[model samples]
Structures are given as structure tokens and as C-alpha cells.
Target: MATAVFPYLPADELKKAEDESNARELSWFLDNLQEKLAEFKHGLEDCYARLSPLEDPESSTLVISTPKSELVKGHVTRVGTRVVKGSLHLRLKTLPSLHLKLSETSPLILPQLSHLRTLLNNALDCVDITRWTGDRHSAAFITSQLHLLHSLLLEAQNVLTGPSFPVPRPGTPHPLPIASRTSGEDGNEHNPPWYQCIPDPNTFAPPVPENLSLHLIPTTSSLILTIRVLEPTAVPPSAFNKFALAIGAQRRLEHDEMDGVFMWKGEEVKVKEKVRVESGGDPVLLVLGVKLQSLEKGIEGAMMSLRAVMGLSQEKDDD
Candidate 1:
């Protein structure tokens, strides 16, 4: 077996080898998830900072109550994380709302807020890879990235609402730019394999051949990964469906038909009538609806189209 460049192993031996490989991948995935969760927790602590003041005088407030009369107070509040109605008393030890965590600290610099909004663009780049870029990755790896992306986006949102806030912990302290040809996703840095044409977010992804279309849809409770099959009429659409079904089968998949490890899943969504699949994480749940485009004799090979949509599972929202 070692001597031949392309050697074949006995069936049972091959299956055993494949099993060992899959176990290793699964182990790696779980470790990564744990690492990311730890990072997320750390980010919550890191997210603490000051909220910038706004108009309505009622709009912004000191995120951290100093419990001092002389210090600037009241008339400042975040939209959702409002200031204590009348006055915050020194005697009353009230636990600030969880949203308060987002309001943490004070005196956030305008530049820092700008940086927070920038981090989101970086997350979008991470997402685009899962859709285009045609990278070869297992569902676990992609799903882990999605979770990280979501956590990071929340951090960025604090800044976007009234000011740009940092996802400081959920991702790298300073987000790196994804290669976006002349203009990078991070705005400053441009990476390799740069091209001239920018992808249109409104329409289905432009690259139609030999590529996987990844969709990241944020739901109330959890983020849902939607992988769209390339237009079946122009392409085979086999690879895309295999990815979707493989993810769906993971939740139970008694047959053990899939090649790799079983991983993340969440509340289900109906992709097609009577066809429900997990809403969050990968393997992403997608319904491949194939319909004849044209039956005319002149039509070449076959004609079909692929469609995708996102939904939430109320019982288990990521929110």
C-alpha cells in the first residue's frame, strides 16, 4: 500500500480509515467551537465601553452608573437600553438589564465607533467566502465561522445604532480586510486574486459555474445558513444538493450515509411545503426545488432553476 502512488485498500479497511479521519475532523470542530465560545464570552467583557451622547438629550446616557450626583447624568439614553426613569439611587442596587452590557463603559471615541462599523464589513467578507470564492470546507468549519460572525455583528451593531461599537472580543481586536480587488472589505487593505467586478448583493451571486452559493440569514434566535444550488439549468446542481441533504441528514441520518462527522443544527424551518430543515448552522439546510424550464425540443440538455429562502423557528430563536 505504501509503495503505490494510488493504492486501494480492502473495503472494510478503507471504511475504518475513513472513520478515523472523520473522527479527527469532528474533534477539531468541537475544539474550535469551544474556542470561539470562550472568545465570545471574553468579548462580552471586552465589549464594555462608553456610549456616545446623542440628541433628544433623552437619547444617550452614561452606560455605567457612577452613582454620583455631580457627574454628568440623565437625558442620555440608548434607544433600547434606556436610562433609569427618574433617578438612579445610591441605595438601590439594581442589576442593569442585559442590554446594558452593550452600553458598557463611557467616553467611546468617534474613531473607535467607526472601527466597529468596519468590523461588520469584515464579517460580510467571511460570509461571502461561505457562498462564493468556491472554497472547499466542511459544514462544521463554515458553521463555526457563522456563529463567530453573528457575535461579532452584534458588537458592531452597538456602534451602528447611535455610534460604531467594537466587536472587540468576538473576533480579532482589529478586523482584517478580505481581499476585495482594488477596495478591500475593511476599506483600507486589499488582498490577493483581486478582480475588477464587485459582486451584486441584490441579485443571485454572479459566478454560475462550478461554485457553491452561501447565504447567511440572521433569525431572531439563531443565524441560519442557506446554501443555494447554482442554477440547475446551467449547471448540474448535484454538489449543492449533496451539501444540503448531508446537513439535513446529520440531525438523525440513521443510515450513516454521509462521509464525515455529525455536527451543529438548530430549530427547524420549512424550506418547502412539508419539507422542513434545521434553520441554524451547517450543514446548512436548503431545499432544492427543481422544475422544468422548457420542454421544447430545441432546448439543450435540461433547464431548471434553484430557489432559497430563510425562516425562523420561534421556539428556539438565536436572539
Candidate 2:
């Protein structure tokens, strides 16, 4: 009598209903999980991109606020093809600077920019979405992965602005040595041909033929100086060389033999004394100085020549 009142549903119908329910539940879970994951991933990607030197051709600036409301500012400027200038303005009064030049063997460990873009499109390749039922463990695992990604981004930033640049860690395997392992023709293992062991200067020095130029832009109350290589692509691995600037009758305004270039404010020009110029005569001369060893040929003074034209217009008294 009970069986007749409640007829049994067919096995196929029961199986179909169960599958449909599972599909709906899985879809809803994936939607929520993916949304969260995507938001986190986007934030990390943005941070990575902002700090990546390769992504920024002009410059990359990052300002991170601390818990104490202080700001730590950092910037990386591409000076040449192989050279990059970095500056960090910490909470302290003094600012630190870094000059990095990538060599042929240097490793740019920051992964390609597209790595995170496709992370979600194929992230589930090995993941079984059906098994993820919004369990606490599953959520925790996702969160861990996001944290790892964030850590990687932070590491990249540190590599750029850290006190020291990244170098190959010891114990890494090296290619086979070109020198003979056994004794040389001299029958001495210690004595190898100079050519075989001599380090190449080109490996660390600037290119043989270099072209550098300097220009000045005058503002309302300041002067902006810019130095750039004409052939940036040809520049080899090099350090931040020195520069000297002279204004008005070859008077040295600023000079540094070993340091990175910094933006010079007009007030910091440090003029020794005021020059007595003829009221209606030639303009003052501005000379761009360079080290003799840095260039093969002397740069034409005319190339960096700038005329400081100062004139006081006299008004006739109107009666």
C-alpha cells in the first residue's frame, strides 16, 4: 500500500537530478572562489609591473606607506640600454642611490610580464574544480598561493633597491672550463697562457666607442641638466662615471669624479662669486666638462655650449 502511494522514480531520472545539483553547486563555488583569486592576483600583478625595470622605459617610482604614516619612496630610472639608476628616499634624512649595469651574463629574474596574465586561464589545469567544495583547507591553500605570489613581487623590488644587487649564488654549476685541466705545455698546472686566464676588460667596462651628450633646459627659476648617450644600444656594461659643469668664464660649478648623476637644483649651483659682465656685451659661457679617459675624442665645446643672456631693459622716463 505504501509503495503504491509513493511510486519510485526511475534510476536514470534520479542520476540526472543528482548530476544537475552537483553542477550548480560547483559552478557557484567556482564563481566565488575565482572572483576572490582574481582580485588578489590583479593587485599583485599591478605591484610587480610598477616595480619592474623592464616595464618602465622612462622611470618607475614606488611610494610605500609604513604603519607609522611615514613614506618610503623609490625610483628606478633607465639611463642607458644596460645602465639603470635607482634611488631610495627612506624615513631618514639622507637618501641612498644605486647604479646598476646589466652584463651579458646577468640574470633578470623578474619573470616575464605575461606570466600572471595566463595564470587564471589555465590555473585549473591540474586542479580538480569538482573536488573543491569551498572547504576551509581549500580556501587556505588558495590564500597561501596568493601570499607566495605577493612575496615574489616584494623580492623583485628588493633586488632593485636593496643595498647590493643580485648575483649568482655560490655552489651554482658552471660551464666547463676552457683551460686544460692537466698541466700545460710548461708542465705546470699553475702556469697557464695569459690569454687563457686573462679577464676581459670589455666584460665590465663601457663600450670602446661611446657617444654621450649633455643638454640643459632652463625653467622659470631653475635649470635642468640632462645627460644621455647618443647610441644607447651600443653602450656596454659600465658604472656611473663622473661629470663636471663650468659656468661663466670656466668657473667650476659642480664636479664629481666618482658618483651617479643627481638632479641639481638651481639654488645648489654654488656660484663662488658674482661675475662682472659688460652691460651690453657677449653672453656668459657655459662649459660641459668630461674626463679624458671616458671619450676617445674631445667633444666640441660648441656641442654643449649654452649662452647665459642677461640684459636689463631700461625704460625712458615719461613726462
Write one digit per residue (lDDT tens) for candidate 2, span 120-237.
2232321233124434234334434433443443432222221211232334422213233211112122222212222223432232112222221211111222222222222332
Error of 1 at 229 (Å): 63
Q: Model 1 — TM-score against the truth?
A: 0.22
Off by over 4 Å in 2: 1-8, 54-319
Best candidate, TM-score: 2
Worst 10 residues of 1 by lDDT: 284-293
Candidate 1: list runs displaced more than 4 Å: 1-68, 71-74, 77-109, 136-319
Q: How big is the positional error of residue 133 in model 2, measured in Å on the Cα after superposition?
A: 26
At residue 243, candidate 2 shows an lDDT of 23
Each candidate: what lDDT?
A: 0.29, 0.27
132-247 per-residue lDDT for model 1 (tens digits): 55332454454445555555565454333221122222222232222222111122322111121122332221222222222222212222222222222223436766787788
